[model samples]
Target: GGIITQTPKFLIGQEGQKLTLKCQQNFNHDTMYWYRQDSGKGLRLIYYSITENDLQKGDLSEGYDASREKKSSFSLTVTSAQKNEMAVFLCASSMAKQDTQYFGPGTRLLVL
Candidate 1:
């Protein structure tokens, strides 16, 4: 049994500002991922890390940066936030690339 936690449940940022969100997990999973969910929209992959110090950019990684500073933590930064770009950032983990993934509650971001 394990749990994942995301900090700053709500984030308010200015347009074009760089905002960061953090996630932590204790599941000892090998794969961690960051996804963005727009209002009423499906999940879009931002970035993923297979292991500590290993980074993989996903389909939607153009405006985001991700880090796997340690096995238990992953962080994401929005390079340049856009107006009306409110979305929820979700963190997920999987034992393997093709395994079922567990997701965090998500961090809501509102760009003003």
Candidate 2:
């Protein structure tokens, strides 16, 4: 069994601020992902990394940046925060892109 950890469980930011979220896993998986969830909507892919130092942009990647510093850690940055909004960011990992993914506890963000 493995576990995923997301840091700073809660994030509060101001409009236009650049905020960062982080994830780490012990599964030794090769594929890691970052997803954003808006109220009443399904999860949206924001970024993914197939291996260390390799990053792939997803549908919502236009306003974000990601990094895979090592096989077990991945991070994401929101280029510009929107005011009076909230969202949940989830981190997941799988053995391969098409394999079952295990998710981490999400990081909740609130922009004030």
For model 2, the stretches where C-alpha displacement exceeds 4 angstroms are none
Question: Per-residue lDDT tens digits of candidate 2, residues 9-88?
Answer: 99999999999899999999999999999988899999999999999989999889999999999999999998997999
Candidate 1: minimum summed lDDT over ten consecutive residues — where? 37-46
| Clash total of candidate 1 | 0
Instruction: Output the number of the lDDT-best candidate.
Output: 2
Considering summed lDDT, which 10 consecutive residues are worst modelled in model 2?
56-65
Candidates' C-alpha lDDT = 0.94, 0.95
lDDT of model 2, residue 94: 99
lDDT of 2 at 2: 97
lDDT of 2 at 95: 95
lDDT of 2 at 108: 96
**lDDT at 60, model 1:** 95
Query: Which candidate should be chosen as best, given TM-score against the real structure?
Result: 2
Error of 2 at 37 (Å): 0.8
